[model samples]
Target chain A: MTLEVADLQVHYRTLKGDVRALDGVSFSLADGEIVGLAGESGCGKTTLGKSLIRLDGRMRHVGGTAVLDGDELPIGDDKAMNARRWKEVSIIPQYSMSALNPTRKIGKMIAELLRARGKSYREFKDELVRRLELVGLTEKVLDNYPIELSGGMKQRVVMVLSTLLDPSLLIADEVTSALDVTNQRAVAETLVRFRDMGFVKSMIVVTHDLSLVYQIADTIMVMYAGRIVEKAPAETIIKSPKHPYTRALIGALPEVGLEYGDERLQSIPGKPPHLLNPPTGCRFRARCPLASEECEAEPPTVTVEAGHEVSCWKAN
Target chain B: MGRYFRRKLLIYGLTFVIAVSINFAVPRLMPGDPVARMLTRNSVANVESSEAMRGYFNELFGLDVPLWQQYFNYWGALFRGDLGVSVFAFPSPVATVVADALPYTLALLLPSILLSWFVGNALGAMAARNKLLDNGALPIGYVLTAVPYMWLAILLAWVGGIILGWFPVAGGYSFALTPAFTWTFIVDLVHHWFLPFLSLFVVALGGWAIGMRNLVIYELESDYSNYLQALGAPNRLVRRYAFRNAVLPQITGLALQLGVVVGGALVTEVVFAYPGLGSLLLNAISSQDFFLLQGILLFIVIGVLVFNFLADVVYVLVDPRTRLGLEGGQS
Candidate 1:
């Protein structure tokens, strides 16, 4: 296993109270595996993605032990985590358009970043150019400013820069949301290609678009109300999902050529529960069709198959 | 680049024409006539001599001509670098009088504007993350920015001059010495200059601190800074980037402040009775010296426009976004 995160609970300190964005989330990624973390907005998928690498201001890490390749990550301690960041773990942020400094040339900015991390820019120059070409960008882009490039180019540049050091695990948080359908596919393919080439040992692609991730993810995990509901191989999650919430989530996506004729596509009946002071039980109990007395007590993660895990009483 | 400068120059040229026209129209708007003001300035014994003096002054000053001809003559003389003669000080050219006081105003304004900008930005950038500095700098910056420049000038003059008697209250220098290039005269000039420069510096210092403090804080929260921090780049690298970007807007503020430099802090000059452009402006207006007034106003307008142009060029060089726009327009 490349990354094994157990009982990771991260909360947001808001004016009202703590928002339990990621409560008791446990999962793991094996070597060279690409796991797509899917959910609705505020489902804590992005929170989980960020927690693995860097927790931004306002995010309080309540409890967690993330072991990557035999070493334990200091996820809660910011200063201690600094020594591990970029070298062992890196993140491609959601807002790629404004990620790089606007006033600094792309080359000088990257050089300065590398220098600050005690890496020699001169040594990385050849590989940086090679990867730039791999992303269909010419080396001339290094001389240009962020605004000089199109949005897709900027996104690709961020991708190459984030994984340049070949981090053991890369958290790609909503990397494709800002892109168009064509660029989305290109970016999705690029992530898989990067993984195949061993640029990143393991990857967690966090996103809301299930269909997009379904095409490239080796395995998929669905989350709701800051809790993971299901995790399985990509095909199993789509073709034979046992959890009621995962089934409804799959039902919401329109088939390639399905004609509704008179009936509309199905959507989840109700909203996810509020994370702050969440109800004590299965978070989706109020919204699930399979909700029963067994769900009143929080469900436990049970292995239904060799690689499939589901946290639902009905599914077991 | 050439196209950008051409467009800028065209705008500046049009502004100059309109401003000069307004300057000419403003003095003529006053009830008093230039010829009449000059006649009364040095009274003659009887009506006959006064009438004779008025006729000669009208011919000499071109006031007897049709208004259209006078307007044309004003432009004609302007093109030849002649600002005409000052009636307030008969036999002295407006250009020579302005030259005499220009150095004093420049001396007071340059060091104050540049130093305040450099120190305020450095202090503000430092205070953005430093809690102790932020707490004290915030309140002081607010109070300083809120104080009126002229009011501050008067308070400083009273306390530093009248009560304390540490600095001279009026004049550009002491009455004990004459103007010279020697060290003694320069020391006296600096001594008299301290209070006015301090007042101007302090008032403007507060504004710069306030602007830069807010700018640096906003920059610290910006996406670029977040991305850098996430990558484990040190705080020094992140802050260096923030400061460079923060200074862009302050450059714009500097250009705006330069407009007031040539005008020489009118109220401050009046309060100190310093012989700078501000006091000269008042004397010109009261005595209806149109040439002197027009010359001073023209200098200020030109100074503001030139500084604005410099700001544009500097912005292009510093900000690559604008440069990309320029290049994108062509390619």
Candidate 2:
């Protein structure tokens, strides 16, 4: 395994109480494996990605252990975790448009960034230029300011910059969310190419768009509220999901070539439960169709297949 | 480029016409005969010879000419940089009085403006990085911003001058030191200027600090900052990147402030008795020195317009998103 996460529980501090954003998420990614984290908004997908690298002021790492390349990640302590970030684990944020500095020329910004990591730009300039070329950007772009580049170009520039150090794990947080379909496909393919080229060993692509993830991810994990309700191979998860929440969520998506009028798609009926003083038992119990007295107590994660996992009494 | 320049020229023309017209019309519409007011302090003494005073005022104030003709003459004289003679300061043109005061105001205003921006921005960046610093500094900054300039000026004068007796109370320089171009004289000038500059610095620094802090907070929450963080760029890199982007909006604001610095520091200058444009304008108004007031207002209006135009050009340079021709070319 290249990455292992065990019983990760992260919460956000609020005026009322602690909001459990990421509750007991456990998973492992094999070498070269690409996992797609599919969920609705506020489903702890982002929290999981953020926790793997750095936690912001509001996010408190209550309890969790993430092992990257058999080394324990010191995620909770920002200073301790600094050693692993960028060089080991990296992320391509959602909006790459405004990511670059507007004042400095692209080359100067990149040089300054490299120098910050204690590396001289002179040594890496060749490789950086080659990567830029691979991304279909010319050397002239380096001379131009960030505003000179188009949105898609900026996203690609950020992509190359993120993987410049060849991190062990890359967390691409909604990287394609802001792109047009064509640009999205291009960027997605570029990510796959990066993995194939050994720039990054394993990856987690977080998005609400299940179909897009279905096209890219080798395995898919579905999360509802703050917990991972289902995890399986991409084909298995898409064809036959065991968890009720996953089923409802998959059923909700309007797949390409499937018109709305052909078969009316239904959205999840109820909103995700508020995490502040969340219900005792299962967090999704309120919206689950299989809710029963047994669900009053939290259901343990059950492994029905060699690699597949589902946390539900019915799945067991 | 041509279109942009033409648009700017159009704006400048409109501003110049409106500002000059207002400057001309306002003085003419004032109730008291400025000539009579110039001649005698009491209105009763001038009232007995009001008709003769009106004729003298017509000749002296250019009211003898037809309104439209006078407007043209004023406009012509303005283009020629020949603002009419001051009523109170006999034989001296309004332009001469303003020119004499300009260097003093610029000297105080420029340094204070630069210092405020530099210190405030640095403090803002520091506050953004450390939550403890932000929490501690926020209230102090707010109090400073909210406190009126006049009040702060008085407080500083009382504390720094009267109580501590650490600095000079008033005036731009010492009477013992003769004015010269030598470094010694310059150093002495600066030493005396310390109190006035410090007073203005405190009053203005607060706004810059608060404005920058809020901007940085917004930048910190932005996707770019998070992206930079994910890139494992050090805290310093993240700060520089965030501050650079966040400070773009403030550049224009600072430039606007710079243009109006002459007119804007009225209260600060008045309280400190600084011989700057603000004090000059104050004296002009009290004496009903119409020409001087018109000249100063016109200078300020032109200064504001020019600075605002420079700010726009800067905006284009800083963020290419504002540049024309390329709209939504990005995906």
Candidate 3:
């Protein structure tokens, strides 16, 4: 495994109380694997991605251990994590359009960042130019300001910059949500190409578009409130999801060849529960059609096959 | 860039034309007649002689002509670099009067306006992230900004001039000395200039500090700053970028605040009795010296416009986004 996250609990510190954004979540990524983490807007998938690399100010790492390549990550300590960031682990944040400094030239900003990190920009210049070209960009973009580039160009530039150091793990957070369908497909394919080229060992693609992530992810992990409801191969998760939440989630998507002339598409009956002071037992119990008294207690992660696991009482 | 500057110059030229026209019209529209006021100051009581003097004075000042002709003459004299003669200080040309007062005002205005902007932005940027400085300095800044220019001038005068006797409260220089290029006169000029400058500086400092603090905080929280921090760029590097970006808005703010600062300086000069354009303006208004008033107002208008133009140029140089907008062809 390239990354192993076990019993991770991250909380959001608010004036009201500590919001259990990520409560006892656990997952692992294999070498060269790209895992698509999918869920609704507040499902804590972004939190999971951020926690692995850099937790924001409001997020507190209550309990967790993320071991990468047999070395424990200092997830809670910012100073300790700084040494490993960008070089060991990096993130392609959601706001790639405005990620660059508008005042500084792209090449100069990159050089300054490199200098601060004790790396020589001149040494990396040729490789950087190659990667920019790989993403269908010219080296002339480095001389231009961020404002001069189109949104798609800026997005591609950010992609090249994030993986420039060949980090072991990359977290691409909703990177495709802002792009059009064609650009979205191109970006997703570019991510796979990066992996194939050994630019990144593994990646967690956190997104809400199930159909989109299904195209490139090796394995899909479906999360409900703050916990993963199912983990299976991409084909199995899309074709035969064991968890009701995952099934309903996949059911909501409109397929290419389907006709909905007579019947309307189905949506889940209720929204996910509020993470702050969440109800005891299964998080999806309130919204699950198959909910029963057995679901009042927490369901264990039961293995259906060698690699497939489902956290549901009816999965047995 | 050439087209952009040409357009700016065209706008400024139009503004000048409109402003000069208004400057000519305002004093004429006022209730008092400057020639009659001049007569009263001379204490010419006899009706026959007063009437003779009025006719001679009006003809001499070119006021005896028709209103349209007078307006043309006014513009004609302006183009010839003549500001006409002051009714308040008879026989002295308005240009000479204004010229005499110009240096004192410039000396007081330049250092105060620039130093406040620089020092305030630095302090505000520093205090944005430091809790102790923010808590301590922000409230003081608020209080300082809330204090009116004249009120603060009076307060400084009372404390530094009356209570302590550390500095002179009035005049551009000591009355005991003659005007000269010697060190003693220069020292006395500065000593008298200090209180008025301080009053303008203190009030403006507060406004700039408050503006910069808020701007820096916003920039630090911007997506670019967050991206840098997430990439593990050191705090210093991130803050340096934030400060640079934050200063862009403050430049525009400086342009917007320039008129207000100039107005404050005017009030400050009046309160301190400093021999600057403000005091000259007050005398012109009270004595109904139309030519002197017009001359002083024209200088102020031109000063404001030139400074605003300089700000636009500086903004274009510092912000690439604005530069792109100016070029108008790029994405």
lDDT for every model?
Answer: 0.90, 0.84, 0.90
Q: Write the per-residue lDDT of candidate 1 for residues A157-273, one digit (tens) a residue.
A: 999999999999999999999989999999999999999998999899999888988988899999989988899999999999988988999998889887888988898988888
Superposed model 1: Cα runs more than 4 Å off: B329-331
Off by over 4 Å in 3: B256-264
Q: What does candidate 2's lDDT look like per residue over B258-309, in tens digits?
A: 8896674777677777778888888888777888889889889888888888
Interface RMSD per candidate: 2.4, 2.8, 1.1
- Backbone clash pairs in model 2 (N, Cα, C under 3 Å; residues 3+ apart or in different chains), count: 1
Residue-level lDDT of model 3, residues B131-184, one tens digit each, is: 999999989999998876667789999999999999999888998999999999
What is the C-alpha lDDT profile of model 2 across A230-299, one tens digit per residue?
8999998999889988899888877768667766787777888877867888778888888898988988
Worst 10 residues of 2 chain A by lDDT: A254-263
* Chain A TM-score, prediction 1: 0.98
**So what's the TM-score on candidate 3?**
0.98
